[model samples]
Target: MAATARSTTPEDITSPVRELVIPDPSSSVRWHEHDWPHPLARWHYHPEVEVHLIRESSGTVMAGDWAGPFGPGHLSLMGSFLPHNWISHRDDSAVVRNRDAVLQFDQERFFAAAGTLPELEALRPLLEAAARGIEFTGRTAVQGAAAMEAVNGTFGLRRLATVAELLAVLAESPESERRYLDSRGGTYRLDASEAEVFNRALGYITEHLEGRMLVPEVAEAVGLSRDAFSRLFAKATGVGFNRTVTRMRLTEACRLLRGTDLPVSDICYRVGFTNLSNFNRHFRATTGTTPSRYRRIDQL
Candidate 1:
């Protein structure tokens, strides 16, 4: 259920990308299953707490700043606004059916209800720890995954009970049987109204990774003035726009360096860094090593 870290990118507390999840108005929880290439399978965070189980496929999972491999039975709980994505390695034409089971609920409301139902209080700490993202192991993983699946087949009180059961299983997991993914830090602060704007801006950045990305250009693309975009971007991402772009480029550079035989200079430009010296400097600062050293160590 656990895999080794695939990238040396130091764990950051938050990411700028956000996913707006709208739960059914009738129910407190949203449970569903989807395929590998579904529209929801991307790097984004939401305000709801999520219990996610991977039913199939092997891929690199990026939760916050933690990147690692995951396969079937991979279960994790990510708290509000913690960016996460499962990047499955498959042929472009391949399709994996029902590859993910996900349950998302408003933990704040659950906590409020716990005041009247004292029995629910025991789960408070587990929900708090989930802000850093928790990966269950051994028996916890097995039972949590089962309980998550059970939520899909029930309705009304039965479905709520199943969700509680899943939380209890995860809450009871020993420290040794669970791994916290993100480092201690702040999470993305985004308003629901601005989610679409940020999503469009982030997508544009991803598409143009091979070229220079300007604040005014991206602002125009997202229908915001340059100054307005700058302020909002800093508030939502906890950093300046340029820094975010640099970090993203460095991430892509690391991938190319580790997985391909591309030259370091070529990688610098490919990831939108016009200066090799600047790329090398930033890589060393973020990863604590030079590009050649990182590739050599990772390859071995």
Candidate 2:
């Protein structure tokens, strides 16, 4: 049977479109709230660092090659040029007001200020990590969202202070409360063809994460020789192809463990691991806890 064609209209969201974000003349950062279905609500990338807060709605949030669920209080930071978007599941005529709160500032300006202010320099590592995008969860998300609201309600120095507070919350988040959103660092420039190839690779990884995945086959499928594909994949994603696959499988396993009642052993094989011991070991190494214990803590 032939697959049904997916139709798209002008309102359809597509990713990585270059966007021009202009801050207000009097403000150093752009802080604004906008409704869903607005012109700016699309998959786009800009040169400014972004702090984003979801005020309402549930949807899939995409950053680079990562896509996952998001809802109210979803807070994240993306460094310059990271492609991102949130697609809310809603009716065609739905209109959601104040669905997103966004703050964008020039990275070079911030870095220049940091060069003079020693205190601001302390956040260097957090800004660096934002190159791959960062998602906050648990208490970090709560605090970050509150800070964003404060930013919304203030102006001048107070707004900037609240922005700093939000960044501090993200920078100090425990590893268990944050997730890096992309394997690909956003610094690498990919032309349209390269971006398409990389997106296809990511799509394949998403679809096959629950099964055995091999590099050679994936390379051939993407129409590159194994060695060439290895170089491009590593350059574009900052990780080896096999390691990326392993990470994705482990991430999926974590989701299942948190959101479903599946037995740990069952989730092990279900996420493409051939052995339960190996699964447990990798999960522990990556997440700093055994799968069963991770679930227990999540439940608590």
Candidate 3:
């Protein structure tokens, strides 16, 4: 439970990332759980700014236009309106699980706390720029992870100090190392038609994940050309069509591994992969561990 911050079942929030209330907003420091039975790779946005410290999981962490394989000690700060998701392979025990500690607060609350402080004010731009998403690597991520972990049990001024230190570390992160997820004004609105297209494509992909999925086939299902669908899919979801489909398949693979008693080869075929080698390769690359090892760890 210390991994995820929420107390409710994962079904409560349809979104991949759910909001967890920090008790005493003023002193809210807690871990939330995000063990959804279903895998999520959809594109959605939130109003709160989020800072995530990913521990012991590996996957494609997508935010706006940025996407990358996340490893242990990975950290990211995403501003409001940035759509993102983490897609990981499942453990062999049939449980698709990963733990992340998220700290979220409103922009207004952040500015109000720093309005009078010139030093803090200087970091506002960085925060604003992160409206898309900012991934930290190397020393900054490691240092930030330590600083954030310090806030886990802190209270009163001490907790606030940890939060400030975390933000300061984020502010000082190298701009070159920080990748943005979306370009300015590139956010897409999901209307009925777009939603229909997305849902249809997603449904079809999920249903046939064990087989080859062609862009043109998906496009035809939604009445769009391959090129048009690809562009729209990326624009609307902040990820490409192939990547989205791969993420979906991988997500399901994780679910079966943790929730079912099926063999790894069976799971690979069930998730639409024709070859076990490719599945294993992708699983290891995405989760940073073999399916069997992941299952073993989760079981313990």
Number of clashing pairs per prediction, in order: 0, 0, 23
Model 3: per-residue Cα lDDT over 191-235, one tens digit each? 546645665665565446677888998889778988889987876
- Candidate with top TM-score is 2
Q: What are the per-residue Cα lDDT tens digits for candidate 1 across 256-278?
A: 77667888998899889989999
lDDT of 3 at 32: 42
- Compared with the true structure, the alpha-carbon lDDT of candidate 3 equals 0.65
Better model by TM-score: candidate 1 vs candidate 3: 1
Q: Order of candidates by TM-score, top first?
A: 2, 1, 3
Give the Å shift of residue 209 in candidate 1. Answer: 0.6
Which stretches of model 2 miss by more than 4 angstroms?
A: 1-14, 17-27, 31-45, 54-74, 81-100, 110-140, 150-186
**Best prediction by lDDT:** 1
How high is each candidate's TM-score? 0.65, 0.67, 0.62
Q: Model 3, 135: alpha-carbon shift in Å?
A: 0.8
Query: Which parts of model 1 have CA positions greater than 4 angstroms off?
Result: 1-29, 36-47, 54-75, 81-99, 112-119, 132-193, 288-300
